[model samples]
Target: MIERVKKYIRENHMLKAGDMVAAGVSGGADSIAMLHILKCIQHDMGFELEAVHIHHGIRGEEADRDESMVRKICEEWEIPFEVYHYPVPELAKEWKLGEEETGRIVRKQAFFRERERMGFPEQKTEDQPQFLVALAHNRNDLAETMLHHLARGTGLRGLAGIRPCGDGIIRPVLCLERREIVNYLKEKGISYITDSTNLSDEYTRNRIRHHVLPAMEKEINPRAVEHMAETARMLAAADHYLLEKGSRLLSGCERKDGYLFEGEFFREDQIIQEYAVLEAFGKLAGKRKDFTALHVEQVLSVSEKGIGRYIRLPQNLYAVRQYEGVHLGKTVPRKAPESTESLVKREKYPAEDFWEIPVPGSLECPFGIFEAKIFSYKKQKIEEKKCTKWFDYDKIKNSPCVRTRRQGDFLVVNREGGRKKLNRIFIDEKIPASLRDKIPVVAAGSEILWIPGGRMNEQYKITSTTGRVLELHYQGGVLA
Candidate 1:
């Protein structure tokens, strides 16, 4: 068992010398064996070892006893130990999350706290890398995960199962079966606490392990975990290829509106395009809920027409049809005018509109237009929330074109009262660099007049006796 773990670690380049490793001990045979083998390996591998025990506060006195046992073991081994004390039920309620997610969050918080307390922010020494959190997931757990995802009708990504290494976490004992861990614990004659809740068939995982796996072992092959693990590896490789191809295909289809797929793509092959769309859309919405085949079929059914339409999905996401395209995304509500039925015909514009010159007026950029305009106030009363603005036309240039920010743009901000580059303005506003190019800036020659959601140039302002009233309003393009 130890040899298998060692081989897996070596293959993954998981652990290295002088690394501060922490083990998540849940008072189980798998975790105990993990700690034992890790301690043995640390000496030869040249890494530091520590243990973390979390008291879920659900098991009453038994939980306290578990913590005490863990502390004693760590003290005997001369290793640093930490314990997280949290109210599980309260956390579950406040976050509107399940027991598993709450437990994970608090335990991670405690681990990082202990790590920082142990002089973190210290870079790796010449001998090794920094630190890593080690888990004790065995082969049976991996198999169970695959089965669970399959039961839930998950996508190909879920079939890849539990990863051995991801970011700061590593599972060195993932290659070993649960029985080997129990045997290892017996060989060492080490006594560890076990949660009584694990015996009860209340949890889904426990039920699967006790009832489902045992029945499978009786009727089917006993080496199910091994076979499943092998299948997972093959599926993971195939999943990688499909993901790459899907992503490449999606690159052309991806748009701000949403991703568009040709309906014929799903009919062609095993790599289902409908599943790909749901997966992609769910990711965009920051979720991975098991969107079923039924959901994909519904999305496909609506997109057969040429005109665009919106279809609400399981999550707070939408599937919309476009001109010769269909997309799934978050739908932004269209703003309608007072007594207006649709978005397009809501805003009333005059065919013949002209205004006399007046003082400077503040104008907000319309939905599609990025630049704010300054013109003479023509209308008597205008709502602050309205996209249109009336500015004093006489205070500024006679004719200025509304456009996006050009390179080498400069602005004299009112707040700072100094000339600064548009790039600097974007940085000061903390606008993500990727979005800076898309931001609209009103410009006259080399001077930037306005940056929406940011500072407006102080140079242009309403003055007294401005005759020409300039009505600055957004025209053409998509409404924001």
Candidate 2:
């Protein structure tokens, strides 16, 4: 098992010399086995290890015991350890999110915190971050994930299953089966804590893990899990290639009023065209989620005419096929000039349109997902792409918020910190007046930091002396 895992790590280049890997140890068998394996190999591989535990607070005393168990194990191995103590239920309720999402959020927060603990500012010259996170997802986890996505109506990315490595995280033990992990623990005579919740079928994942995969294994092929994972791996490779081709296909589209894809776009295969439009839509929105096959088919139906009227899309985005090809833009609600109420409604942001950005967290806006994380910075080269950007953390003085432009909203211009009205920005940039109200703007206090599809304020940009950098990565936005 160890040899196979080592080979997998080698093949994947999951670790590099001088990597300070923070292993998320949940005190569960999978995590423990992962930590043990990494610990055994880390020294020889010339990488440092740290163990991090997050007490989810839902399991009461058992949760505390889990933390203690993980701590003792780390201590025995002389590993540096830290515990992220968070109230999951309270956070979930306050954020208006489910327990599952809240847990994922907190875990991500814990990982970033550990990354900050590791010394030095990451070099821009480096393709990967200096510190990396290793997860314990096994073959069963991957199989369960595939089933979960399949049941929910997923796209190609979802069907690709759990990613082994990306965004500064790697799943070293993902190549190992659950049984292999258990056997490794037994062979080494290592005792580990198990979460009581895993035995319960209350959660969707729990039910799937306990019933769905096992049934597939028994009723169908005995090697279903292995075969499914292998299939996912192959699909992931194909998806990557398709996305690259789709990007090239979508290059001709203009984002101002809406995407204007030339007739050349429709020349691709129908399957390729579906993915191509999906990518284009995602780029315009700054992130597209819950986008299903139905959405794709709806857009396709209109384009089949080679000329169609405006087709309203979900999330206020709209599409139209014309002599100029296809145009994807935000749907602007027309109002009567005679109606006073209509004029008033157009002047302000809707109550539901704005959401607060959590400190060191993520928020969902109409544009897409903006994940904010802070890290101490000593500037190396910062490659600013269209979708992702970074800012000087200390410059943001208030809780960040995401919403459509409001009256008097402005972005800072010039080194003097002079202000420019957002409306003026729109006009200056030749942005269509119709699309201004629909564009997503991220404001830190009174200052507008980023207009996702538009311009970012230069005054708040990260500098060499900046102590901390705020990474604002937007998913579903224009990508470079």
Candidate 3:
């Protein structure tokens, strides 16, 4: 078991000399063996070590015993130990979250809290190196996880199973099985605590471990654990390869606002590209992706349309198809005040009476302004003459302020005295109800001036009699 762990550390490049390490000791055989192995190697590894235990307060006395056992083991090894108590059931109820998810959150929170509280650890003097947060998810655990993900219809990421090292967590004993860990403890004459809740059939994972695995061993194959573990190991390697390749491809096609990819990318033989986009999009959303292949199909359907279309994403973000490209951006603008009570706080204004927001650039004012320079011919091609309003360079006033629409705001929408309310125009345009609060309408008193990158009042529109044209295109929101 020790040699296998050493090999895993070396193979995965998990740790080096002179590092601070924390172990999540659950008092189970796997964690105990991991803690013991680290302790045994401490002299040669040259690293500091600490232990953290999270008491989920589920099994009452058994939970307490787990914490006590971890503290005692750490004390015997002369390593630092921290314990956290969480009311998992209460939290599960309050958050409307499953108990499993609640426990995971609480455990991770405890780990981070202890990490911060302990401060930076001193460099190892003679040990190999302390493996940071060494978790004891063994081969058997990996088999179970793979089965779980398989049962749940997971994709490549889920099939990859627990990573050896990710974001400061290390699973050092993943190369060994549970029985191997127990055997190593017995050989070393080491004792560990056991949680009785694990014997119950209430939890799905518990049932898998206690009943399903034993049944599989008897009915299917005596070496079911080994076979399943081996399959998982192979799948994890292949999944990692695909994920890395996909990430590289996705990065090349990414943009600041969102991502753009050819429809063929999704249609290609390589499904990894789509997964990579999903991974990037998930990160941009600041949340885990809940999207399935069906959702991807929906996105692909819109992308194939070859016209501008918007699909609402899970977290209020939107995926838009524009001119043979797909864009992912926040669908909803950040909510801000619509009232004019804070108008007097304004400072800088656009030069002269007309604000020339400089070509090939953006101008930041009280509201958003984003602009791009396009050739006259190209501009004519993309711009909808009806939706777009161009201003004559001479008629434009340099002094302009960007603000929300107010009462009595009127725009001469047409040459025939067809005056209309700015709010009414927005409503008629079918702008989303929630977005009305965010669109910044350029105004010069009660007269609606330019809607900036959007529709301008007919009074402000440049006609055939008008001279030179400088186009200011306005979208649904403030450009800035």
Candidate 4:
């Protein structure tokens, strides 16, 4: 078991030379065995080890006994020990969160505080291995998480279950089963406290452990826990691949206030699409504690409509579709960067303000005055790309107003008509941010019909089948 765990740690690259790892000891068989295993390998691995114990203030004297036992174990191992006492029940009420969530938060904060107190980590950045908080999630814990996620209706990420290392926490003992940990401790003559609450089926986790797991073992596969753990690892690898691919796709569609998701975002497989939306929410949300697969579905559903369509999410964040892209941002403007002046140029047309369009009529904006005329398809001789553009008039349902680009404006980039955020296009084309107001945009809803010299949205362009053609000619100022 020890050799298998050591192999798992090495395979995951959980530690490196000169690293400092903190083992979170709950005075239970799982954590105690993990601490011992880590201690056994630390010298050869050339890393330092310390132990941290959290007194959650729920089990009364049992909690104190747990802390004392961990302190004693740390002393015997000649390693530093840190203990934190957090009133998790009161804090849970105060924070309006469940006790389980509050306890997890408090424990994480204590671990971070301990890590900081231990002095500066030698390395920082993606390439270097992180100094981590070692957690005691065994194979059984992983199987329980998988079952929990499945019960809740989850995606690939949920199926992936508990990660070995993420956000500075490492579960080095996850490769071992709880029974294996208890047996290893017994073999080593080490005693651990068994939390009495664990014996009761009061909690959902306990019910799973005491009832569900035993039934599965007796009636189904005896190695069900190991099988589930193995499945989780495979799913985790697949999730990693999709995340990397989605990240690249996300970079193209993201904007300043939120992501301008469209085109590749929706064109990719559903797995990538779901991952992208989830990632976008994580980026925009202050705390990503409550988003779910349902939220992702809602976002995607609303994102396919015309401009101004939106779905409000938890924490006041929303995903809105405008023109060619979907934006994920707060429904209310952010407080800090509110001074950043936000998206869409606030420049008022010096010569004119925008008005709704009528077919074959003239409209005026600050940049220029444009004349629109519709003629029969046979009479069409399209000319002058600089000052004029032709569109299939019959295809345009609503009157596409000729004006400056608005807050949610987007442009279709290619002949295939994949959408790109207007701002994204400006940045991609190296159009000076200052030149945006000077650009004349003809748009209908979120869709941009023409950006004058830049592009005539491919979806609206005159095709050979065009029976009636609409010609737009700008007559005044810079665009002319």
User: What lDDT tens digits, residue by residue, belong to model 4 across residues 256-368?
Assistant: 77787777678888878887777877777755556666567667776656577555555667666678777778654233212122212234553244656555555544344
Report lDDT (Cα) of residue 183, candidate 2. Answer: 90
Candidate 4 residue pairs in clash (backbone atoms < 3 Å): 323-446
TM-score for all predictions?
0.62, 0.67, 0.64, 0.66
Q: Identify the runs in model 4 with alpha carbons over 4 angstroms from their true place.
A: 121-123, 126-130, 331-480
The per-model lDDT (C-alpha) reads 0.65, 0.75, 0.65, 0.74
- Sort by lDDT, best first: what order? 2, 4, 3, 1
lDDT of 3 by residue, 1-480 (tens): 677777878788777777777888899888889988888776676667778888897888778877887888889888888888999888876775556678989988887777667664434333444436778898778777776666655776676667788666788888887888888899989998777767676555776788777798899998888887677667778877876777777777677776777765666554775666666667677765545554454455556554554555445556667775766666442432233311111233322333335543334443433242322221221235432445544455643345666678788877886888888887887765555555566666667676654567666555555554555543221111
| Colliding residue pairs in candidate 2 | 286-475, 286-476, 286-477, 287-475, 287-476
Residue-level lDDT for 70 in candidate 2: 94
Q: What lDDT would candidate 2 get against the real structure?
A: 0.75
lDDT agreement of model 4 with the native = 0.74
Q: Give residue 452's error in model 2 in angstroms.
A: 29
